[model samples]
Target chain A: MTPAVAFQKTSRHFGAVRAVDAVDLEIKPGEFFAMLGPSGSGKTTCLRLIAGFEQPTSGSISIFGERAEGVPPYRRNVNTVFQDYALFPHLNVLDNVAYGLMVKGVGKDERHRAAEDALKLVQLPGYGGRKPSQLSGGQRQRVALARALVNKPKVLLLDEPLGALDLKLRESMQEELKQLQKALGITFVFVTHDQGEALSMADRVAVFNDGRIMQVGAPEEIYQRPASRFVADFVGSSNVLPPDFVQRYAGQHRWGSLRPEQIRVRSDTSGDGVAARVVSRHYLGAATKLSLDANGLRLHATLPSGTAVPEDGAHVMLTFNRDQLHLMEEQA
Target chain B: MRSDRSQSAPTGLKIAAAAGLAFLHLPILLIFVYAFTTEEKSYQWPPPGFTTQWFAVTWGRADVWQALGLSVQVAAISTGIALVLGTLCAAAVSQTRFFGREAISLLVILPIALPGIITGIALRSAFSLAEIPFSFWTIVLGHATFCVVVVYNNAVARFRRTSGSLIEASMDLGADGFQTFRHVILPNIGTALLAGGMLAFALSFDEVIVTTFTAGQQQTLPIWMLEELVRPRQRPVTNVVAMVVVLATLLPILAAYYLTREGDQIAGAGK
Candidate 1:
């Protein structure tokens, strides 16, 4: 099956800053693919390239397998819900939603009907006449979402669409956006700086840094088998120990990552695990996250609530299952 | 927060503002008040009597009619020219970065910022140097030099405040260059253009100094009023015409105020 979008050594620069490096990837059709990175990782730049708001400086970008180098943003067969929810402040909700259809010369009555349909799909019905400023933040977001969806694009790009919402509202919108994507069966390319957002919402997450996609995989794969030290530290916290390749589980001097939730607490012992002492304990609901100081290295381990809780500054053994750890070649 | 500050003005400041408003408008109110007084030219502290006979007489005179018609024609023509030249200049200066962007901005706004006497004298000398005899067209051109600045100020501020995203959004949605500007940019700046046009027309309507310099052997309303003030033949007409000018100028100012009410919203530049 043809990928919905593809980049072939695409590069873009703003002045002297390499906003997007020469990178290659293929986004499968109907996949909720997220470019996951911290601020300035070129995730948003890639979305802009796909949306035709920007052109790759020296490489190729293909949308639906067609060369999109010269295509302007308006002519692109994709739409974006901007981070700030760039709703037209002058127009009321109904007119803002009907904008694309109206611009395409659709009749007033039909465009309004279709706009109403899109509004209902976002679970907001009959809010058509209220101005954007008059609506709450969530309502404005839904209106912006409706504005993009009204055009019926094959690929919907979201530029941190939920970044502006409060914590509880953001969670609900994330689930709703995911459900909407599935229901529409449209390809989605979401750009975000929050790792948790990418982990939770996307089927495939592409980890990026310094303008390059370091690794791309399912959220589980990225979390469990990060390919590099940067990915290990970026996806979740990690504790690195010098490898004992010969004596321990074969080829063990390579840096390894441990998930915070992947470790177990045991009695005051030092065998069947990396020998360590608990330096600090943070009590969280249903679990207590502990930081261990193991022979000059700091390690993170999360233990489920049980009688196995260890006192702070107590010497204890921490064991990670051998197979759960992947050796990463530490860069010199 | 700033809105709250304005709302919480002290009583002293509030009274001062009111006094300033009266200082500016009380003379105009006096002109309107005496427009109906039977006392012709002499200052009657309070009117001895009031009559509408002067209004009837002012309405019937051919010279008054011609002068009124001339002022209307000049204001209309000057406004049209200002709308075109000002919008184009504003768009050019705003959209493109050039070697002389600052100089161009200064040139565009200098007419409005400079004293009217400066503009009048400069235009007069320029006309003499060009050997162009003064006429209605020359008057329109002179008036438009300043009027265009008004239009340019309004339109450019609106253009700058309009998010480049809207234009990009339009282009990305498949609109060609002209269609993008016509549908997206035009609607966004529509009120600014209307406001600018109304303001330009008002400024041109009561303009006297510039007209005096360029109105060769012609009788516009302000010039006619000046002549009537100096050589009082049928001079109660001046007071009536003053009332007419007061109303005509006020109407456009009101319309412009209405049009520009949301300009602050549309003109939100990146602060």
Candidate 2:
């Protein structure tokens, strides 16, 4: 099948700044894809390019086999749920959701019914009569989602849709959004800077940095086997052991990544492990994070909550499972 | 602590505020009082006596009626032109960027910023040079020059405050340009436009300096009132007309104030 969205060597430049540079991406139909990066990493720009809000400076973009570069957003069969809900304040919830159908010349009664159904899909039933101003942030977010979903576009682009919500609400919304995408079976292109959000929610994730895609793969692959130093450092905060460190520890001269949780720390200075001094300790409720110095090479290790944490400035035995040290390709 | 500080202003500041209010409103109160004065020729202490006959006299004057009609017509047409031109200008300046965009915005606001007499003299000379006859349209053109600024000021502020994502969301939801404008942009800026139009009407209705230069054969109410003030047949009659002018201008200004009082509450603001 043709990809739901494809970019051929896309590059969006603003004067001297390369907002999105030489990007070649293809998102499959019905896939929950995420473009993950820090701010200004071109993730949002790529989403906008798919939505036709921003045309590539030098590229050809296609949406489901249709040329999309010059196509206006209104003509594209893709809708966006903006970061700011962007609900029309003047319109009540029903009208805001029904707006797409109304503009498409759907009959008022039919559009109303469809809007009510869309509202129900977002679990906001009976909120039709209230204006957007009257709703809470989460409710408004749902209304925005309903507004976009009511259009029934083949692809949906969400720009950091959960950034403003509280942690609890954001977690719940993530689950709801994942379920919604599965039920609707529409291609979802989610942009976010939060790696946990990306890993937990996306089927396939693209890690972006400096206007370039560092790596793209399944969530487990991104977490377990990052392709580069940037991905390893950005995705899961893994302890990136240098080539020298790897050569000394694992008998190889390749850069390797060891997840913090995979590193075991024992308070006793015992045999069969590298001795390290605990520089600092932090209690994180579920785990204790320790900054360790193993002969001047700094590393981090997370000990689960039940594990006895050593006193600060104490020497400890640190051991890493041989299989857990994943090698990366890039030198930098 | 905050409520105590807010509720109890210093006594000196209170007196000063009362005095300032009195200073501003005493002149207006005098205008209202003199409208009912019996004296028809000259100023007097305590207005000599009060009467309602001047209102009837002012009502019967054909010149007053003609001037009122001209003023209303000019104000209405000017406000209509300002609403369209000013809104378009505001949209262009606020929504998009181009070379000299700031210069164009400054140019749009220049007429209202410059001294009125300078604008009046410049308009008079431009009209004569262009050989455009001074007619009802000339007065409207002159009024619209400044009236556009009023509408532009309000509309541009509102346009800046309104989130651009609303327009993007509209388009994302399958709305074309016009539909996005009508459904999203217009509703967000509607009150600002109405308030601007109201203020434009109020400004155009009582415009005197520009009208004096532009209205060669026409007499807008203010010009009529100006002439009546200089050479009076029944002085109280002019004050009665002044009272009407005050009310005419006051109602719309008040309405504009109330309409824009909650301007910060535009949807999606701070979202």
Candidate 3:
């Protein structure tokens, strides 16, 4: 099947600022894909382009193998859940949810019934009469979700939909969104800057930076084998081996990275790897992450709670198999 | 604690507040008093006895009726023009960005900022230079200048307070431009526009400075009142007409104030 959406060398510029630069990508149907980056990284711009709020300055975009050029947002077969929820203050919850169908000239009774069912889908069954001002931040977010989903579009675009929620609510909403995607079998392209959110909820993650895609892959693949130094530091915490060490061991053409957990911390000095002394140790319930100073080079080691962890200032050896170090080609 | 707070108001402050209220309202009180006075020609205070005859006399004047009708017509037409132009101006200034946007905003508010006499003189010269004769429409055009400013003032504030995302959401939810305006933007600004329209009507009804330059031979209510004051006709009858103008303009202003008091709590305002 053709992908749900595709961007062909799409670029959008706001005067001197290149908001999205030469991006080529595709989103498959019924998949939960995430665009992950920091603010000003063009993630939200890409989402806007897909939603048809913005047109590309150059190149083209297509929805389900058809060109979407010059199409107004209302005519598009996608809906967006804005970052601020953007629920119409003038409409009650039910009317807000039913707005799409109303615009399409659906009968009031049928649209109201569908809207009520959509509200129930987002767990806001009895909230039809309340104004948006009466709801909490989380409830408003759910209403925004219901408003978008009620349209039953071919794809749903969410721009940091949970950024305003508290940690507990954000976590639960993430799960709810994942389940909703699965149940509806609709393509979901969510944009967020929170790395953990992308890692935990998405089947595939596209890491963006400086208006360009740095890498795109499954969560584990992107985390374990980052395409560039930026992704290594951004997607998750990782210790980058010094350039000299990488040249000496992995050859000069590649950079080496080792996950914190991949480094073994032994209290004794008998090890095949480099010798180090523990500088600090953090007790993280099921594991202990120790910061080690190995011959003036720093390394982080995460030991499972079952292993013996070295005390601060204790002499130890750090060991990792050569195969555990991941390498990436040097960028030109 | 409440008693102590109430007592804390100094005697001097109390007298000052009372004096301010009296200074503003004493003339209006005098107008009401003289309207009921039996003395028809001369100003005698202590010998005056109150009667209801002047109201009947004022009601029987055909000039006063024509003047009142003309004033209402001018005010109504001017307010209608202001509502459409002012709303369009406010929406453009608040909702979109382009070159000279700030300049356009300043121009929209300039008519009210300038002294009424200056606007009056400028309008008189422009109408003459363009060879347009002063008539009912000229007076309406003059009133609409300031009335547009009043409506624009209320409308732009409300528009800025309203969320831009609401419009985007409407479009994303399959609403075209007209549908989004009808379903989302209109409701948000409805109360504000009503309040603005009422205020514009009241201001146009009481307007004299601009009307003086624009009314060629027609006498609106204010011009009629001015002429009546100039000549010593049944002075009590003039007072009765003044009382009607006060109530006619006062009610809309008060209604506008109440309407706008609750407008700030717009459903999703600031959110």
Which parts of model 3 have CA positions greater than 4 angstroms off? A267-272, A275-283, A291-298, A306-316, B1-8, B263-271
Relative to the true structure, candidate 3 reaches a TM of 0.94
iRMSD of all candidate structures: 2.1, 0.7, 0.6
TM-score of each: 0.85, 0.93, 0.94
Q: Which candidate is the best by TM-score?
A: 3
**True interface contacts reproduced, per candidate:** 0.33, 0.96, 0.96
Clashing pairs for predicted structure model 3, backbone only: none
Residues A90-172 of candidate 3 have per-residue lDDT tens digits of 88999989999999999999999999999999999989999999999999999999989999999999999999999999999
Per-model tally of clashing residue pairs: 9, 0, 0
lDDT of 1 by residue, B1-271 (tens): 4466556778999999999999999998888777788877675769888888999999889999999899999999999998899899988887778889989989888777777788889999999999999999999998898889888888998888877676666665556688777877788778898888887887888788888988898888888888888763545678888988887678767776777776453221110
Candidate 2 docking quality: incorrect, acceptable, medium or high: high
Candidate lDDT values, in order: 0.83, 0.90, 0.89
lDDT over C-alpha atoms for residue B252 of model 3: 71
Q: Quality of candidate 3's docking, in CAPRI categories?
A: high
DockQ (model 1, Cα): 0.38
